[model samples]
Target: MSPLADRYGRRFPYLRLSVIPACNFRCTYCLPQGYHANPNAAQALTLDEIARLLRGFTVMGMHKLRITGGEPSVRHDLTYILRTAAAVPGVTKLAMTTNGSLLTRRLHEWMDAGLNAINVSVDSLDRAKFARITGHDRLDDILHGVDLALDAQMPSVKLNAVLLRDVNDNELPAWLEYLRERRVGVRFIELMQTGDNLPFFRDHHVRATALETQLLEGGWQALARVADAGPAREYRHPDYAGRIGIIAPYSKDFCSGCNRLRVTATGDLRLCLFGDFGIPLRQFLQADDQIEDLVHAIGRQIDRKEQGHFLHEGRTGITPHLASTGG
Candidate 1:
């Protein structure tokens, strides 16, 4: 059967899989300020389950996969999982989203295991501020990992910077300078009020438009038509090797070209980031369902997808954190 297409006619060719709900850092904005670093109430998917689920999705015309998590690098079997996921038929692109601190020793193995690209989360360039924002003093480790990723020849290594007011927002130019020198893609994300940090969100959030203005005034050139290119709107300074992108989930919602769905580490399929409900694939796994059945199950979930999220509607509903909802 052909894979399901939403009412907007976008095909479901992408799946963002969260390998685990656990994370090493307790980024203040990620959860409540001073929130514990424990995993969410959800249980993550096992390796066998993820492989079997991907096999089914592959059969159903899924083409791209992103291995994400609280920090996918924190998962012990990440290299093995990446290898297995890449080996699956029809998976043309295999990628990961990491915090970059743990990429020291395993990066080479991950590249050998066929990770096509990577996106690393880097909030601040200043070591002290980095430690304050991420609740970790591993800035040196993260910087080292970035070099390793470039060395491993990972195609399109993006450095994701989550912009916060009065925090790392002042360091955007410095970030661009550092990353451009290394020829990496630097993406800035607008802080969202969703998830466990709803209260804290009010204090730290900044509009992406404001951020773009800051970057341009600082001599950065805006790349044309990036807002139309899905979620992240990219820009660059002329002659700079690195490009800058902004993910404005709060300020500028990108629901029209959203051809992505999320499969939680635990196997619950989520249609939209703000949509709280998901279909449980674990039942099918336990019942020994056929590959097609699992595929159809995912398709059914997509069919029920809402037009977009209600974030702009005063953030009425509380969405899950970045960890629970894989990027």
Candidate 2:
């Protein structure tokens, strides 16, 4: 397999593909005002186009593919999308990031279609607080579906929470209790500044260092990150059945180990989540024979990936929100 590495020696093995730019739920940190469809926006890539796109990625040795979105499960053809991704040669892991609202009824169907791993967004464990944070009161049902996924022996089951100061930041003890007997992995993502959320970012952003110190004092040991893992610093405790991960983007040298790339739903290659530009791949996706051009185009851009994001400099490139590029 050809390694898709940049001049900085970072190899890309994981690819996040946004199947759709629309989501059903309104998470305070991500989609606070709800998703507004752009009528002039290019329609999402077709199934055939997705298949061709995955082939180009697989040739570059990308083995793990995570289907993201505003919410991937909201797509009517998500099963086909998963199947197309899984069918690609060298693409061994087919996973998805979802709100998990449909997991209760569609988990088996998704799994049957070659979905082996899943990451669900669960911001707050408290039902009422969760409703306030996500604008949805399905916390109980979401957790129930997670339990069912574990019972079904799914290979990987994880939960993601965007840490907010004075909001859900104090719920670590409750999370620990929930993780006591479960093997699921929970990752707390630090709030990131995006193009349109400055006011909200200022009010709710919190550092993940405090949580790391708390975990260290509480006996959690750092876990070894696998080669194709996402950008999370994981930790494990001997007594607890589950593990914890922190995605502190503002932490020191955060992008030093970036092993992933993202593609927008409309077939644009995003080198950095916050990069101001996107190299259009739609032209190459028009035909199956265009794979060569697509691969070379991607390879050329790898050399252009910046050392890291400019969030520290108060620069959020073209991304207006997390849902825009499946953050």
Candidate 3:
């Protein structure tokens, strides 16, 4: 494998690719009310073009590729994209992030197509409350889709529940119970700066420390760290085969092992999720730019990644929504 380290000594071997700019649901913490249905209607990359970009990334020593979206499953050709990514020479893992509404029928095919794992966005359990959070009434569909994932024997299926204060914070125990019964991993993601809906911080935020205390009280033991986990501090229950993860990007910082980079659906290279800067890789690809040139440019961009995202401490912020950058 090629040396993956950048000028700042940060290695870059993992890449998150957003195959589609469009999504099916309108989660309040994500997209805005009048957000365009097609953020890239004028410039969505074709599946073949997306494959070419992945090829470039692999040539630069990228080994792990995650497919994210505006909801990745909503894309009709998502399986094709996954297959293409898995088929890349140096790429070893192809995972996806989705809302889990559309996984009922196609999950088996996805597994067969070399999709190694999945991260489903499920915030609330109460049907009406979920609708309030996501502006969609597909909780039942999501539940069914999760079942389908376990049934399909996905290697690393994880449920991603973004905890919100007063809304779902009190329901963490209940959510853990539900997953415990099913024997699936659950990850609680602290909500960060993303869409226009995040207007204030005082009432909406819940720190990960509070959630960890609640989990311990609820009988979930903290299993020691898995080897070299990038940002998440993982724990496992005593008896259950499943585990739980806490991503505390807000209260705690994991900028040191931050080796990830994002490729927007329209093909911009986002260096850091919270930093307001990116170089347009799609523009170069569309201009028939050479692969080696693209790799060198991406290396230059990662060398410029911000030291950290200090939003609460009052710093300049990234302009694009978290969805656009593969949060």
Per-candidate clashes come to 1, 0, 0
- lDDT by residue for model 2 over 1-327, one digit each (tens)? 479999999999999999998999988888888999999999999999999999999999999999999899889999989988889998999999999999999999999999999999999899998999999899999999999999999999999999999999999999999999999999999999999999999999999999999999999999888899999999999999999999999999999999999999999999999998999998999898999999999998899999999999989999999999999
Question: Which regions of candidate 1 are displaced past 4 Å?
Answer: 32-43, 214-230, 286-289, 316-318
Per-residue alpha-carbon lDDT of candidate 3 for residues 1-327, written as tens digits (9 for 90 to 100): 365565667777788888776677777667746246654354666777787788788877778888998788777888888887788788887888888877887888888889987888888888988898888899999889888888767777888888788787777657766866676777888877653445634557778888787667867776665322346677777756677888888754567667778888888888777777667887556433577777777766666777677767654356456676678
Candidate 2 vs 3: which has more TM-score: 2
Query: What is model 3's C-alpha RMSD?
Result: 2.5
In angstroms, how far off is 322's CA in candidate 3?
Answer: 2.0
By descending lDDT, how would the candidates be arranged? 2, 1, 3
Candidate 2 TM-score to native: 0.99
Residue pairs in collision within model 1: 45-265
lDDT of candidate model 1 versus the reference:
0.77
Q: List the residue pairs that clash in candidate 2.
A: none
- The CA lDDT of each predicted structure is 0.77, 0.94, 0.75
For residue 61, model 2's alpha carbon misses the true position, in angstroms, by: 0.7
Residue 175 Cα positional deviation in candidate 1, in Å, after optimal superposition: 1.8
lDDT of 3: 0.75
